[model samples]
Target: MRNKIRIPKRPVDTTMSKTTIPVFIYKPEILRTDRSLVVKNHTVKPVLRTLLFVLTLICITSAAGAQTAEELFNKGLESFKWQKSEEASEYFQQAAQADPNRDIYYLYLGIIYHQSGKLQEAEESYSRGIGLNGGERDRLLLNRGNLRTAVSDYDGASSDYSAVIDAGGPLSSSALLNRANMELNRSSFLLAVGDYTEYLVREPESPQKETIEELLNLLNTRLASDAQAAATAAEQALLEEERRLAEEAARAEEEARRAALMEEALQSLSSSGEDTKSISAGSENIREDFEDSALED
Candidate 1:
């Protein structure tokens, strides 16, 4: 104000007055870059969350779909117990398909088939069950034996029953009784007696006393008849053997006697020849005639 000085005007593009406020720096590029980074983080977060949720759902579904073989087996048994034959068959078939290694499934299936009167199917099922494992083989054998007996297949029944006997356990008495019945039907008295005796031996003493006594009486009658027949056969065989031996001895003794007589004759002939050698020709002739007559007599 004391001395007014004229300030030079400067070009806007080149220079600024010292009194001018410094121009504010507008960093538009930095602001835009930070905003883009925020958007990227937000987008990625949602995608990652969606991926995790989908994975968890898949795991849950997979776990739910899994079921144990034994659980399915129990379901099949329940179906069978309700007398739903067709439904039971389907359940068992499924179980068997799921775990073909289990023999009990096949066994149950066989029983169902038999009850349904599907004999051939039942037989096949039982045969397959037996082939699978030995644990229930006795039951299969006993059932088959019963089937064979029903069909009058005595030989086959006998074979199966005998197998049950060899397998042993509580089924032994039933098998023995069945075998005896088969033998009785076939008129195999000796075999029937043997089986009946075995049954009696294995049976309990108290409850079956009267029944056993009756059976024993019948068995004893058959056994006595068999024993008498056996005795008669043995006696016949003995008589034939004795007759053969006696005939052989008589032939041997006759041969010995003939040999001794021939030897004595030869000795007598030799002595007579020596005595004749010292006699006159006519005396030798007479002695020869007398010796010939004596030999002839």
Candidate 2:
């Protein structure tokens, strides 16, 4: 998906036809400056990512296991702040063991677990922390959402992102941005657009404004495409339903016509039966009169 924006123009003549006594077109050297912004746009923002990570670092008061938990937790934080993964993990593990009741203990421990590639442990820790009312609801959900995405749990990720948004924390825009990205991945075009729109409304002066604006335009296009497709499908369905109803009505009319003909034929047959009986009775009376005339003569 990461691609540099380049515009290509055709030469006036057949450049490769130089060997046939024709002209040649030299390759235009795209100036270095022309690609800088494009490159910057495609490159990952490491500093922003790091800052977001730092924001999730928790500071909890381990009351019952004060000395041990406090010492270990501080050590974990200091080590993590200095980018010491192993040391931080060790400290966080010990701190969490010392004060299992402190929600933050499990929260940061889960973060260190993820950093160390202990995905299962990370997931379990996050779940436990969330259940115990972790350090910061918004930050925890954000982290869980990210982890869910890494594991291809799109629905779970969306739910976490939504929870963060509903919480209305300082990172609401960030949550919206993440949710938008997730929606885009799932091809939920207009939904993603909605999230990005909310993001713009929340943070008007965001440093990533230009990039977000570009993304918003692209998402809008996708939304339009999806809407068009849906409309087309709906129209087709309507046509199909109309065709079915027409066929059904034609069949019902044919059946009714057949029933009417059958009723008329039955009535005619009954009348013919009654006429035959009347003729038979009249012939019987005439025969009796002839026999009486013979007797009288």
Candidate 3:
């Protein structure tokens, strides 16, 4: 018999809260209960980045005034921690509406939507955030690009990543790392190498230094292999073409030789036939003269 753990429902808090977003935290289901659990080692995706900018929102609206946008955003984070994703999204949505100028509201909403598997909503949330015309466009672009990549929108994701790099900020290094990953997936080994090289240059102390180095080495080997394969293919094609041309030339020369032989044979046969005819004609004249002498006798 197997036992099932029931997740408890909690009331949503509408108060201002403070907690750091868990960048690499395990799934909530793991921490809930441990019972007859099959412990298996499975590969998980890595968390790319955390706050390049400190976000501190600890303001709650007074009873006399409406709830502040910061308070709503903080409340959304609290709901998210409690595993109340839908409620959290609502809070973030309200926060976004309350303050159209604040991009953080939309960023939170985007993250929540993305986690909830609402991919279209997630993308639109990021775009909406960017369209708000707020600060830290790089962060928004990075997040959006990651989302796009997750959904297999390679071209759109690539464009966003390139935009991040062109924007020129601390996150540009992260963007480079992401773009390298993109190129790697596409088997553009040399392009990936360039991106990885640039990422290392921009972030000398990158936390992923060892992993990046290993990947770079692997990519270098792959690039060499691919180049060798291409060269071999081209050489083979050239050889095949040369061989075909050589065969054609041989066939043409043989045909020409055959034609010349036939012409020479025909000329020899014609001359022989003409000499035989002249000899026959001389023999016939001698016969006629002998006949005339017999008649005189």
Candidate 4:
């Protein structure tokens, strides 16, 4: 049975068939698990995009904040030009706070404070601005000196003027003039004269030349008159004291002479009294002798 089975032979056929198949693309469903996962991924993508957008916005806002200091300063200047003092002060204050190291900010802040009648605050702002090493430092110092002068702080004003002089700037002439005026007000006449003379020498064509000359002439005349008056007063006082002393000496001499005369008169009277007493006794003795001789006779 195995040999009979082996006698049957298998036929082999080779055939090649070619056919075109159509591919279909369908939209993903949102409700199914896999589709839902894809949708979640898309949703998460949007959330990440939103987060990135927010971060970008934060960065932009930070950059804008960085620029706000200079912008606020310019805005303050515009407000000041418009005579909006309070608004200008507000803007300037914000600018100063935003950029404390900026000399212009502090300087403008000082000006706004001064305009608003905050003199102390203005002085502080000016000082801060001066400390910032800016180009306008001399101007700020001069302004502060003027303010100090307005308050009758002559020494403080002089200090500012001295600083300007030491700095060797264009403001020196005006500062010297102001310093001279301050010295005059404080009655430091000699110092004022020297400063005024120096100022005149430096600025021969100064507009205040006439006024300075007048003040100097007046001070010189007054000082001379005072010296003359003082000398006259001293001479008169010396003469009066001499006259008083002479009169006192004369009175003392007269009292001494009168005392000597009184003593001499008392001595003469005593001698006269003794001589009269002796004569009376002798006359009595003679009369008694005469009576005795008559009785004997």
Leading candidate by TM-score: 3
Local accuracy of candidate 4 as per-residue lDDT tens digits, 1-297: 111111122122121012122222223335446433334456444555555445434432343354578876876788789997766777677777888888887777788788778899999999999998888889889889988998998888999999997887999988999899889888888789899999999999999899999999998887788889999999999999999999999999999999999999999999999999999999999999999999999
The 0-to-1 C-alpha lDDT of every candidate, in the order given, reads: 0.71, 0.75, 0.76, 0.78
Find the candidate with the highest lDDT and give its number.
Answer: 4
Q: Which should have the higher lDDT, number 2 or number 4?
A: 4
lDDT of 2: 0.75
Clashing pairs in 2: none
Task: Answer with 1 or 2, whichever has the higher lDDT.
Answer: 2
TM-score of 4: 0.57
Clashing pairs in 4: none
Write the residue-wise lDDT of candidate 1 on 1-297 in tens digits.
022222223234221123232222221212245335222345445555555545434432332225345655675677688897865676677667778777787888888988888877877787787787667777776777776776788898898789888878678688888888888788887788788778888885637557756876887887898889999999999999999999999999999999999999999999999877767677978988999999999
RMSD of each: 28.4, 22.1, 12.9, 25.8
Steric clash count of candidate 4: 0
lDDT of 3 at 65: 33
Question: How many clashes show up in model 1?
Answer: 0
Error of 3 at 105 (Å): 2.2
How many angstroms is residue 27 displaced in model 2 relative to the true structure, after the best TM-score fit? 71
Error of 4 at 264 (Å): 14
Write the residue-wise lDDT of candidate 3 on 85-195 in tens digits: 866777787777788788888888888888889889888888988887678677889989998888788899899999989978788888989989988887778889999
